[model samples]
Structures are given as structure tokens and as C-alpha cells.
Target: MYKQFLIIIIILVTTHKSVKGQDNQHPKWNTWATWGDQNNGTYRNPVLPADYSDLDCIRVGDDYYAISSTFQYSPGIIILHSKDLVNWTIKSHAVADITQISPEMNWDRMNRYGNGIWAGAIRYHKGKFWIYFGTPDEGYFMTTAKNIEGPWEPLHKIMGEAGWDDCSPFWDDDGQGYFVGTNFKDGYKIHLFKLAADGKDIIKGTDKVIYQSKGSEANKLYKINGTYYHFFSEVKADGRTVMMERSKNIWGPYTEFKQLSHAQNDMNSPNQGGIVQTQRGDWYFLTHHGDGDWFGRIMSLIPVNWVDGWPILGKVGEDGVGTMVWEGKKPVSGTKIITPQTSDSFLGTRLNEQWEWNYQPRADKWSLRERKGWLRLYAFGSLERNDNLTKVGNILTQRSMSTKANEVIVKLDLSGMADGQKAGFTHFGHPAYSAIGVHCDGKIKRLEYNLKGQVTEGDQINQNVVWLRSVWGFDGVSQYSYSTDGKNFKDFGPAYKLMWESYRGDRLGIYSYNNKQEKGYVDVDFFNYTFAGPQKTKK
Candidate 1:
């Protein structure tokens, strides 16, 4: 009998330890879905399998840092850090508030849906980290910090003109700074410009168009072995392809070079990303599959082969340009498996690094302190002054991971919901944004799904607490369901198609807004997410 009692105690202790370990770690939503790290010294394409659109990577000693375009999301330009190139952690958002770039980016304006911060480049220059980007409508901007996990300086408008995109800054060996970008307003002309010594302004009278083509953009300039290599993307007769040019001089009469990558890619058109060389002197090209669907631009790490001074991305073919490669031995190893955190318990004073606001959020409308351990979003009218869910402010979200299948479950406390407050979970993307929400009207608490402004009401929800869910398939269709008891979920809306709108993928979001009055609020208890993961490929 004592032996049996001791065994029972051992079992209880073991179970308690397991639970305690989980409680100490950031909650993981999926048992498998999030991939890239194979845990076997190899990783698959897209070191990050999500909407890290128009990404750029650079190596600072042993550290690998990447930046992605956040578009209208506030605290813009997502920053990430990885010990090895395969796994990553969200460091922080580079831009604290994007309104400094343009008021249209303001939540009250809600005009720059897909227009803010386009393809940018992150470079550690002269002991400081510099980020430069262009908005299609707002010209060019730059931000800087001494540390990667920053307190970055407010964005400075480097160029005030418009219609340019995808910019990069390069510091020549002689200490002269140069900028390269596509002046899309000028028929996709890739221009080279001299930069001011401070790297905050584009020196006037130094702009020169070196190349022009349809959709010729995503420019990055590099000087290797005394030759300046210009890498950019062009929409070919086949599709968007990555091409190159080289010149002995930063300014040229440059030699038109070979294509670096083919249009046929596992990442659709594998173009638009930065190149990095490992500590071992090996090279890799981290590019995004530009021809992404609803998942936005998923990233891929392709091997870079240097032939006769030309950096070729991916596997080279008989035709000579590179093609997509899906798996590779990790560039750096012995690092722990790290994926961006997703599951939020709302236990911290600050929102998770994985979460970003739809736009410049109203500071007064959301709180982590209002409720001890919940995300509290206060009710307010759409900043754009309408009923569009896309226009509503203070919607906290994270990129929906790209996978065969993934889902999100969110628990919401609706007791504080005021009359006319719309609050709940959403799976919103670029044109086909939709949500499963709780609408509080008078004494009637109803359920509804908003699919691109078409609202369909479901069964009346009487509970002050509810759980909402959205499941997405490989085909980019999302079906939402909800449960009042947090256990049984019933399908609430039709399956909705998701599209990559404004160059971004669908995101899992929790929001609260009221078109009528701003008297109520909703507290998000937790967000549990999961996905079907990619199996590790044996090297």
C-alpha cells in the first residue's frame, strides 16, 4: 500500500512539473504547424513561414537580423533576430508610430491601407543600425538606432517626392554613401543617388537612372571584389524575376547581367530580399516568393553560388539562372529552435512582440493594465468614420502563419461591452477580411460575421464570456466558429476567401469598436493558436 501511494505521488509530481514547465514558457498555439527549424541541423525554405513581406537580412558578427514591411500596421517595419538563420525571434517593431511619416497613416485617417512603409533595407553601418524604406505615396524615410532591439529614432523623410518604392542604402569602401531604389513613377526606373554624410537625406543633383523596366524594383546595391553589383526584380514575360547588373563604378553605364533567380519557384516568384554571407564565408540569398496569394510574401533562404563574381541564388539550371531550393543545412547551428511567439495569455503589461496594431492606434483605446491579466480594447467608432472593420482602430493582430492548416481560438470577456460595441476574434486579410464578432446592442448580445462589410447575424449570445475561433486551410479559406462555454464551438459564418491585400497576408486579430457610441469595452482573455507543421527534411 505504501509503494502504491508513493507511485501515485510520483505520477502527480511528474504531471505537475510538466504543467509548470508549460506555464513558464510562452504559450504555443500549434502542436506542429510553425516550421523552418527542423531540429536536425537542417531547415526548410522560408526560415519564417509567414507574411514577413519584402524582407531584408543582414549579419552583424554572429547575429542575423531581418526587417519586413509592416505596411499600415503601427509600430511599423517588423524587426526580428536569429542566432541561426533558420529560427527567429521578434525583436521589436522599428517604427513606434508611423504617423510621423504621414498623417494618412494615422488611425483617424485610415487612408494608407497598403501604402505605408514598402520594401526597405536594414544595414548596420559604422556601428549604428540604419533602416531606409519608401512608400509609394510618401517618398522615402529612414530610421536609426545603436541597438537592434531599439528605441529607434523617429523616421526622417529622406525624400519628399512620391511614387518611388523598394529602397536600399550602401556605404562604399571610401566612406561615401549611396542609395538605390525604383522610381516607379518614372516607369520603374532603378535610380542611384548619393547620400548625405549623415545618411538622413538624399543628396540632390546626384540622382541618375541606371536601369528601367516594367516592375523593376526591390533594389539592393553591393560592392564585392571591387565591383558594384545591383540586384533588383523585374516582371518578365514569364513573371517577376530577380536580375542583376554590375559596374566598376557606383555610377554606370553598367553591364546588364544575368538573371539570379527564375520565375518558377516554390515561393512563386522568388524575388525581393537581401543577401548575407555566413561567418564561414558561405553565401545565401534570403528572398521572398513575391507571387504569394493570401499568405502574402512568404520568405525563402536560397543558397547563393558565386560564379565568375556573379552571385546566383538557388539551384542553377541548364538555362543558367537559379531555381528554388526548399531545404538546406543550417547556416549557423547549435542554437535553440526559435519561432516568433504567437499564443498570447495577455499576462504581460505590454502586448506580445508578435502582435501589431492595424495602424497608428489610439493610445487611449486599448489597455493591458485596465484588467489585471487581459487585453482590454475600449469601444470606439471607426477612425475612418465608417462601419468597415478594416477602418476600425486598436485591433491587435499577428501574421497568420502559412501552413496546410492553422487555427486560432480567442476567449473574450464581454461583460464590459457597452451597447453597440462590436467585439471579438477575426481572421482578416487584404481584400477578403472577415471576422466572427459579438455585437452588444441594448440587452441583446448577438453573434455576427463580417465578410468585407457584409454582416450576417447568428444565434444570440447570452454569455458575458465567449470563445471565438477561425480555421484556415492550405487554400487560404477561413471558417469561423464560436463557443459560449469555451468548449463546444459552432460554425458561425460562411467559409470566406482570403486574399493578399495591400501586400500583406491574413492576420489573426482581436478587436472592439462601436459605431454608435464609445461606452463599452471588451477584455481578451487569451489567444490560443495552432498549425500543421512542416516535417523536418533529412539532410
Candidate 2:
């Protein structure tokens, strides 16, 4: 019978391409989930394999965006979006309350794990969309937004002056308004300030310090053509350097400086970031990699060369420094293969810009409309039963890509858990972490792991729907697994080892706590992230 009508037309065209690949309003383009598009248009370099550290980036017309450094998480500045600066996505988040600058980030958990919101700079100027960060314990902040995909405009401290750290903001060419920072407490010096053309205050005396070296700081201010440069990042001992300086005058003895990357061949210390250009003019240099490892400071795009007025970053040879570029070309030619912001399926209503909330979440205890599609979380426990996992406040994280192997899975429902609750799927970092749970106790549920800080106990999940998974390997090791019929999973406990605390790397949390009585809640419903071997067949 025509082979049974071509096997029912090949199972209805593979179930209509798997229901149009789950259609999350247009997702499909994982390309191994991290790293630039390698659909053969040739691209690679950290190009965003993960840990989008202190970079900056800006373009505005054909769109580019790029801002990073979320230090204590909570939403404080992430914004990505790209049309061709080598694919990117997560397009919004510029503060949604890190307790609006410390309420000890939520009633005294003080988990500013590595200090909040460090290195910043992202500008569009005049039509709005400027950013500017710093927080060696809350000092210089600033926000603005004529929309770079935001509602932004809350944080605006403008220098209460503490230790200051990598900051940048500039607008000149006659409209004059400037601010540049980095005063790691008086010696790592490199200050400049003078804004107030409505850039919001600080024209007091113009603060000047101009420049100082050795471990300089990630500064970044530019003018080009008429000079004024001043890009930075300098740890040097044969590593993180990528300095520069110039002056037709933006305040200085205005010297010349220039070091521009010598982190050479293996490209281990590329240093801070910022420097775009490409609408076919070609400039690039959006670095990171200051020797970070467990996956943290990743991002890199190098390849810039200006020479006479300085700008050199990677591959300039014959001793003018520069030399990174793992593989490139493709600055902006019909780009459209974006990637970055992995799987979720909590079926929308808000909460999947790749998630984030290790700190500022208590907003009525987390929900996505109470169980409609699932992502309820809600047990605010932990006043100390040995409160670890950094004092457990609403966990929920993401960013653990630099792939060579990955897996995330999550489907937990546990019938609104409770009796000293515990709901899980972790692999978070900071003195290490592990988890894989469901530990209720009064109606008896048990099936825990907890690992680093040991807890171990398993076999007692009479099912209410569970699925937790963790995987991850490429030497960062991680294991944990479970499944109550989400198709047989099993493994559990011990293998952990993924480290890199404070400045972060090794995330994938989604926890839910209750040291004893915050009443229960857990619902996740779906997360599913995947990535396979050989760096997904490299490019």
C-alpha cells in the first residue's frame, strides 16, 4: 500500500520538526550553546564561551549592545544582544534590585559574594542608554536608558567614593561630559571626572589624576581622530596587559603610554575590554580572559589595529605587542546566528532571560503566576541549620558554559513540597556545592545529596514528579542525577570539584530551601540544557 503511505509520511514529517523545535517565540540556534557562530562563516575565540566578565561594546544603529559584570547577580547589568559582534542574546537586565545597592542584598545575607556590580561602561549618549558602574562596596553608579531593551534608570550614586574600580563614561566633541575611574584606594590611580551636562552631577572640581600604571584598571574612554584615547587593563608580570593612552587633552600631561597586549600565543591574559567599530570599518577588541579558568572571565574578540594613533590589540607583531585571535573573520556580514542564553521551558510569563537571582529575590518569594507553567520556588528558609550554599535565598542561577560537555535538566514539581522543604538541582559554586534533591521529611520524602558539606541520603522518592540532573565535565567535573520517570536517570552524589568562587563560574542552580520552616514550594517544571563532547566539534 505504497509502504503504508510512506510510513505515514515519515511520521508526519518527524512530528512537524518536533513541533517546530518547541518554539519559545523563536529560539533554535544553540550552536553548542556558547562560543560564536561557527556555521562555517568562520568564528571562534572566547567570543563568549561563557563568563561575560567586564566587557562593554556599543554600536547602536545596526545594533550591538553588550554590557557585563553582574557581580552579586540579582540582575545588575547584563544586557547582550548583537547583530554581528559574533552572535549574542540575553538582551536586558540593568538592575532589578540588588536591594537597590545593599540592604545587605536582602536583609543581611551580605552575600555580596565578590562585591557587587564591578567594572562598567556602555554608552549610546545623547539619546540615552548610558551605564557606568563601580562598587568597591557601593560608590560610583549611574544608569540611564532610552531603551537598549530596558526600563533602566534607578542606580545613580555618582561617586560616594570608596576604592573605585574600573568605570568609564564619556561624551565629548563639544557636548562635553566625562568620567573615568579606577582608584583602588589612591595608588592604582587613573581618575578623571567632569560630567554634568545632565549626565547627572559631578562637575565639582573635575577630580583629575589622569594616569598611573601597574595593574592599571579597565578604564576605556575614547575619541579617536582628534586623540584622547586612554584604554586600560594592566596586570603585567608577563600577563594581563593591554594598555594605551593618548591626549590632545581630555586632561593630562597627556602622555602616550601604549602597551597593547603581549599576552601572546596561548592567549591567556587578554585583559578587560571595549573597542568596537565594524559597520565594515573593522576594529574589534572586546576582551576578557585575565587568566580565569573554571570558566569565568571568558569572552574575547580581539583583532584591532590602528598604529599611528594607537589601538593595536591582537596580532600586530614585530614587537608592537598584540597576538591573540584563535580564529576570526566575520565582523559583520549578514550575521544572524546568535546563541547565548540556554534552554528553559518554564513556559513563559516572564523569567527566562537565562535566569539569575542568587541574591535579590524575595519579591513575594518567587513565582511565575503561581503554577500556570511552573517555576514557583518559594521556601525562604535558612536562618541557620548550618545554612550553606551561601545562606540560601532563592538560588536560581545560570551561566556555566565553556562547553566540552554539559547537561542541566530539571523538572521538579514535588507537589508543593513543605515539611522542612528542600527541592533541588544545583552545582553552584563558592566553597563548592552539589545538590540533587527532594527532602521533605514529615510525610517522608528523602533523596538528597548536598555533597560539599556532606549530607547524603537517597532512595525514598515516592514520586510527585522529579527530574534534577547536573552533568558538566571538561575537567571541571560535576555529577548528580535523579529522575522519577522522566526517563530513568539514576547516578547521584560525589564527583563535584567544579570550583571558582566569588567572581563566579560553575552555576546551574535552581534551588529551594527551608532549613526548617519557611513552609515549602518548588515547581520548576522544565530547564533542559545540553551540549556534547569535543567542544561540540570545534570550528
Candidate 3:
């Protein structure tokens, strides 16, 4: 009887522990993600199936934090957090406005489309979190804070010269600082320079040509076990594959580069990213597939194997290179699932971290406080002189994940609209743009879909509230939809092709603009988004 009682007690304790753990890691995108943890100690590829390109990651204690590129997007340099490498969440962003880098970055100019914050790296050093990045037209920039969730210092220009990109900072054992980056104007040469103690300035005259090749870039520096490793991506015959070199000295008589990954058949290659070590002393590489598509360069986590003082990415082959793995055991386990932020209810005063503006937004034009539980957007003329919907300022957007099937619906309240105002669900990248919105002109409101100047107008919308939607999938085709009663959505607009433009993937955007005058507004109540797993997503 005693033995039976002990066995029952053990079972109850185990069950209670599991339930509590699941509560903490609850809702890990099992329903909305196309790829991720299998929940059986393994995770699938493209760990983050989104346009989180040119990523860099670092591990602090048992927590992992990563930062990714946000070219032309305000509040640039998105940050993500995870306990285990497989499951992640949007943590915060590094900058409030990148337009401060140059006037060309302003929404009104719209000249900095393919240029803004490029590749960067994040590190925790001496009890503070540090981030360093560079733009092609601008120079290098850095920001730091004592905590990862920061009150970060404002941007401080490190290198004021242009034509440089793909930078990361490193610290020596003696506490000396260094910065490595590519000078694209100089044949994509990788340069090494000494950094100031505060990491806010480069010590002049310390520059040296560390390495250069045909298409060598994606510069990252690390010191492991008394040897310095230079990790980067270079263009090879198979496309851009991850490559690495090592030296006993920082300014090296470095070894000949070894190819770390081989290009796969379907894609350009897996290249350019950062390497991180887990609490268990195992290493992994958080990298983006170098190929760009409608969904941009989605991310994949690759295992790192240190063989003969060299780290090989992905799985090793007979050629001494590695191949991409479709799935692998997770780096850390027993952590609950935490998916990146997506849909929003507009119930809170602040926007979710997922949302970013096309450029520096006109502060006074957008508001959540005007209405208690809705996002109020005031319509204004296009920031661009022309009438392209892509140039409309303050088009709020989030990353578009590269899943097979995904759908997004927006509930917009048009009661507050004024003459000449058009507002609703939209999407735009460098190549093309489209919108499904309500246009109000002279007491008349018409539901319409506009794709690259092609107008598809629906019946007059007498109702003050409407739901506009978009459904797209792996094939990169999108169709617009809308409903007056929030059910039985009717498809509108021609079939749209999602695009990769300006170094960015297609993003889900909500826009409000007026070609006639800046004299009206729209209120958004809720945004609901759903993405399917291997199972198909349907409208």
C-alpha cells in the first residue's frame, strides 16, 4: 500500500510540473506558424519564416537575444528574445527613428528605399547591452543600454564616412575594443579598426585591410580559445555560402578561408549571420537564407561543429563543407513557447512591437489616445510628390512570414472619415503596392481595391464599419477581400503578386491617405492574422 501511494504521488507531481510549464510557454504559434518546434525535442527549418534578414544573435546567461536588419523602416533594428533558440518573440527595437541618419531617409523624400539600417550585431558587455550597425549611404552607428529591455542611448555615429556596411564589434581579453565591417566602395573589402572605450567612436588611423575578395562581406569577429575567428559570407560558384577564417593575431596572418556551407538546389544560399553559444557550451548559427523572394530572406538556425579549431555550419559533408539541415534537436528545452507578436486588438494605448512605420512618421498624424480603444489615423497627402500609395507616410506594417498560407483581416471604422480620405488594409515593398480601402468624397464612400494604379471599386459602402482582408501563401499570390458584416468575405481586386523590393520582403501595411486634401481620418479597431502550419491556410 505504501509503494502504491508513492507511485501515485510521483505521477501527480510530474503532471503538475508539466501543466505549470506549459502555462508559461503557452501559445507558441503551433496554430499560426508554418515551421518551428515539433514539441518532441526537435524543431524544423526556417525557424523564423519571415523577412528578418541579416540577423545577429548573442546569448546572455540562459537567455538568447537577436537583432535583425530593418532597411527603410523606422524604429530600425528589430530585437528578438528566446529562452531556447527555436522559440522566439519580438522583444523591442534599437532605434526610434533612423531618418535622423540623413534627410534622404525622411518619408517625404522616399529616397532611402534600398538604404537604411543594414546588417548589425548585438552584444552584452561589461553589464550593458550594445548594438552596432551601419548604412551604405550613412556610416556606422551604435547604441547601448544597461538592460536588454532598454532605455538605450540615442544613436552615436561611429564612422561618419559612407559606403560601409555589415559591421559588428568585438572586445579583446585585455578589454580593448575593435570593429569590423565591409567597405563596399572599396571592392567590398573587410576593414578592421580600433573602437573607443565607450564604443561610440572609431579611433582614427587604426584602420587596416583585414581581408578582401570578389564578394566578401557580412563581417563578424570573434575570439575563441586564444584564436581569433573571422566569420563572413562570400560569393562562390554555388552562390553565397557561409565562410570563415582564423588567426592567432587580431590583425592576422589568417588561414585560407574554408567554406562553411554549400548552396542548396532551390535557393541562392544560406549565408550572413551571427554565431551564438548556448548555456550547455554548444554553439549554433542564426542565419538568413541569402536568397530574396516575396517573403525576403527568412531565417534558419544552423548547428555549429568545432572540428580542428574551425567551426563548420550546418551538416558536414565529405568535401569538408556543410549542408543545410531541415530539422534538428533544439539547443535548449523545457522552455515554454513564445511566438513573435502579430495580430493586435487596438485595446491598449501603445502599439505592439511588431508594428513599424515606412519611415519616420509624422508624430501628430497617428493616435491611439484620440479614441479610447482604436488606432486613429489622419489622412494626409502622399509624402512623395506623386500619388503612389507606397509613398503614403506612416503606413504601419509588420514582417510577412514565409509560410504556405496566411490571412490578415482588419476591422476599420470609417465613421470619422472626411472628404477625400481613403484608408484600409494595404501592402507595399520596393516593387509594387496595393490597397483595399474605403474612399470618402463628397458624402459618398466606395469600397475599392487599387493595385499599381489599377482600380477595382466595389458597391457603395453605406455601413460605417467594414472588414478588409488579404490572403496569400507560399506561391506569393495575394487576393484582397472585404465584408460589411465581418463574415462571408467577398474577394475583390485582381490577383496580386507579393514582391521583394528595396532589400525588403512584402510587409502587411495599414495606410491612410488623401490625394485631394489632408482633411479626414480612419479608426482601426482590431487586426487579426492567422498563418497555417503544413496544413493549408484558406480565407
Candidate 4:
């Protein structure tokens, strides 16, 4: 009887803890906290891994799969899986090593910032999954795998057309597969072509102009109740709006287009989204919005309804935007504490998937050891900082949170930075800013923090060896200080506001940078970070 009672108590305790965690990670996306009040519903940003922008999603049975535009960033294709479209987790990347694509590329020109893989397509067909992507400056390509985790086959060039971005494939119910893509430069026309049965090549004779867009890039098609709907973007009177057209046949004499949603201050780019039918037989649209950050391009959802055989997205009276869809007919079938992996202790065999290098990291940038419990970042590259160009070593970073105020404290043993070697914390905006440990001219020094364009200067405290602490608060504010005894510290100087000259968003994190010729390393003990509300205290 006692054993049964104990077992019941343990189960109850575990269940309670689990519920609390779910509340934290998977916050109510439907509420105003997730999406803002611009629309009739909630409007909080950065839904669905804001880190993955230019996203494309699909729903199969109960499983939801998504892939994002991995422009210049290697680990080119990130695949995410979710039972509930609102909650997703990265399962594995379709591509891991950048070298697999090109030996000369290292997040430099080939993975050039803002270039590469604009938007791609992922479709499962006839037991195989395929990814069709194109470089805006280059051409279109395709690759396939029996399993999505893939031993993804070598990339095969499908077309070298210049003026295209997102390309998609539709397998018709009548037993044929057709490819559709946006030609943005020439005519903004949607071209269609039938693919060979083997799926390896497009039939040379099947090319035809199916639809023309006033302004659209990401496009997809759906057939409902005998009407084919071509959902795409068009620059309407109010700006760029999501518009749709319908036809009785696959190859449209598509009907006149009607605006579904308007882009309000780019808060509703509504670029590419997928229509998913829940098991309950209800329909929903999964989409994205921009927060103006490098990775702040976020995910959103809206309840989609098929009316009069044409899918009417969201309700009419409601503001036509990407409304956040949080809850569904059912609760997420599994645990809800869904969050990307963060807070690495440097003891793991490899960096967590959540962390990404600022540029293509060289093989000699850093080293890790479990026994020592630290990540050693070696000094490399000159101080000629261009956030998109510099090859600073050992930069493992994550997207800045939307929280009002967040603080990150990195503990490091900087006893190894010799004269002419510098190392410490960096907050990457644009022009890449940082505060470093200084060993200059036979004196232990701390230089004013400045890079590309951002300027944060600390008091010239003449101390050779010291522990460092740099903090970046909300609203582009920043500060730094050092502790000679590793406990008692002095404020470096006046608080400075970080401004990225050419940077895209408010992305800030810890980084180790070296601006010397002789190679050296900074041993990071660990990083501890916390998010504080505006009312919380910071010392």
C-alpha cells in the first residue's frame, strides 16, 4: 500500500513540473503576447524559430515538416518536425558540411550574406523526398533522399535561370507532377512545366505560362472542391498583399485575383505559408512575418476556411494579416516545453544545433575537451571588421530574444591572452562590435570596445590579467566592466548604445575575437544568461 502511494506522488510531481515547463517554452502564440494588436488577434513576434526565415512548411497526416532559406549560412538545409504546426523542433539538417557544396565557399562570397538559397521547395513523393532550390545570381538545382535525414544525393542542376527565387512542385490528383516558379525580373510570371516520370528531369516540351503576378515570389497551389487556387503575393493598392486566383483546371485560366491580406509596414510580408488540415478536418494557414532582424523573420498562423469552393484566408472583418493561430481543435499531443537548445557548457562533443558560426568557421578556430570543461577560441583575423566579412574565430551565437531586457554573463579564464593578443565578449550587430582582454605594449590593458561602426569604450584600466563581464541590454544599450580579483569589479565607463552601421537586426551575443598576427586562444569556462523584465534589477 505504501509503495502504491509513493508511486502516485512521484507521478503527480513529475506531471506538475512538466506542465509548468510547457507554459514557458510554448507560450500562447494566439494571445497578444505572441502576435501584436495590429490585427484583431494576438501579435507577438518570433514565433516558430525566428532564426529560420523565408520558411516553407507542409503538413502530412499528423506530422508537420518545414525548411527555411539558409542564405550564406552553411548547414544549408535545416529540417524541422512538429505534430502541431505551432510547435516545431529541429530534427536534423539536410546539409551539414558547407564543403559538400563547394570547397572555395566559407560563408564568404558563395554563402555571401543576403545571398544563396532565397526560398526552396521540399516535397515528398513516390516514397522519396526532394528539395529544389536556386541561387538568385546562379541557377536552380534539385536533390533527393529516400529518408529526409538524408544521405541527400549530390545536388543536380535543374536550370540556370537568373531571375527566380522560390520554386515549388505540385503532384496533381490526376497522377502527374508539375513544377511552378516565380520569374520576378522578366515578367513576374508563374511558369509551369511537367516533370518526367522518373522525377529527375523536367520535360523539355511541357513549358507554359500559367499565371502572372504583379509582384510575387513564393508561390504554391491547392485544389479545393474542384477549384484550383493559386495563392501568391501581389503589390496591391495598399502595398504587397497576399492574393489568390482560382480556376476549374490545373492549368489556370485562373480567375481574377482578389486580395486576401495586405502588408502593413512589412509586419505582414506573409511571404510563404502552407495550408494544413488538422485531423479534426479544420484548415489553418502557417506563415511568416518580419521583425527587421537578421533572424527576426518569424512564423505566424491564421485560421483558413474554404468558402464557396475557394479558400478564404481568415475572416473578412478581421484585419487581413498573418494572425497568430495558437490553439487548435486539440492540445499538442506531446510535451509542450518546445524550445531550441541553448546554454552550452562547452563539455559536449559538438556545439548544440541552436548555435551557429558567424561565418564559415575554419578547422583551426577552436578546440574542445570534456576533461577541461571549456571551449578554447583561438585568435584569428585582423580587426578590419565587417559583420558579414570578418572571419573571427569561435563565434557560437543565437538570435536576440524579444524580451524587454536580457543579460548574458560569460565566465572565462583569459590568463592565456599574451601581449598583442585580445579576447573577450562581443555583441554582433553590424560592423561586429566587441570588448576584449588587452595585453598591449608590455602592459595589461583593456581597450575601448569598437568595431566596424559600433563604439563602446571602457576605462583604460591598466591591469594585465583580469576577468571580464560585458552586458548588452534591450534597446541597443550596452556596458562593460572587469574584476581583478574575479569578484570585486569597477564599472569601465559611460554606458554606450550599440549601433550596427550595416547590420540587419538587434542580434547580440558573446564572441571571442583576436586582432593579432600570432595565434592565441581564450578558454571560456561557461556562459550564464538570464532574461529580466523591465522591473527587474540589474547590478
Query: Which residue segments of model 1 deviate by more than 4 Å?
Result: 1-35, 265-267, 383-386, 536-539
Q: Kindly list the per-residue Cα lDDT of model 2 for residues 1-539, writing each as its tens digit.
A: 99999999999999999885552121122232435666667566656767788888889788888888888878778889888887788988888887878787772474577888888998987788888888897788888989877798888787776788998988888998898888887778888888988887678676888887676899988997777888887766765677887888888677668887775525457778899897777888877773446767778687798887687876787988776656567787766676777788777788877788887877888888877888898886664565376677778888887566778888887888889888787777776777778789899898888766578888898878878787865567878778788888988877777777787777778878887787888888788888652124647
Candidate 1 collision pairs: 29-529, 29-530, 30-530, 32-533, 33-531, 33-532, 33-533, 418-520, 430-501
Please write out the lDDT profile of model 1 over residues 1-539, one tens digit for every residue: 99999999999999999986653332122222335877788876666668888889999999999999989897899998888778888998889989988888887877887788889999999999999999888899999999988889988999988999999999998899999989888799888999999999999989999999999999999888888999998998988899999999889889758898888743477788989999999999887764546777777788899877888887787877887776678898887777788898989898889988888899998899988889888988985555578878888888887677788999998899988889888777655688899888898999988888788888898778898988887677788898978889899889887777767778888888988887898888889998766563345
* Candidate lDDT values, in order: 0.84, 0.77, 0.83, 0.60
TM-score of 1: 0.91
- lDDT (Cα, tens digit) per residue for candidate 4, span 1-539: 99999999999999999986564343432122332221222222344434466667766666778887665455676677876665566766665665444543463333344555567777877788887776666667778888867788877767766778668777778768887778888778877879777666677778777777577667776767767777777676666767777788878776556666556543545546667677777776667665444335567666676654545565443543332333333223443535444456788766655555654566576777623678777766543543222354445566554444455666666556655555666655444454444433244555545454344545554543455665654354666666777677666645555543332344445555545455556677776655532122335
Clash statistics: count for each candidate: 9, 1, 2, 7
Which prediction has more favorable lDDT, 1 or 2? 1
lDDT of 4: 0.60
How do these models rank on TM-score, best leading? Answer: 3, 1, 4, 2
Best of the candidates, TM-score = 3
Q: What is the TM-score of each candidate against the true structure?
A: 0.91, 0.39, 0.92, 0.77
Candidate 3 C-alpha lDDT tens digits along 1-539: 99999999999999999986654331222122446776667777768878888889999888899999998888889999999988889989889877668877776776788888999999889999999999988899999988777778889998888999999899999999999999989899998999988778889999899888878898899999998999988776756777888888998878657888886636447787888989989999888873557788877788998877778887788888887766678898886655788999888887889999988888899999989889999988896534477677888999876676789999999988988888888778865878788989789999888787566777799889999999987777899988999998998878888888888888999988887887789999999998765322346
Query: Model 4: which ten-residue window has the lowest total lDDT?
Result: 35-44
Q: At residue 286, give the lDDT of candidate 3.
A: 88
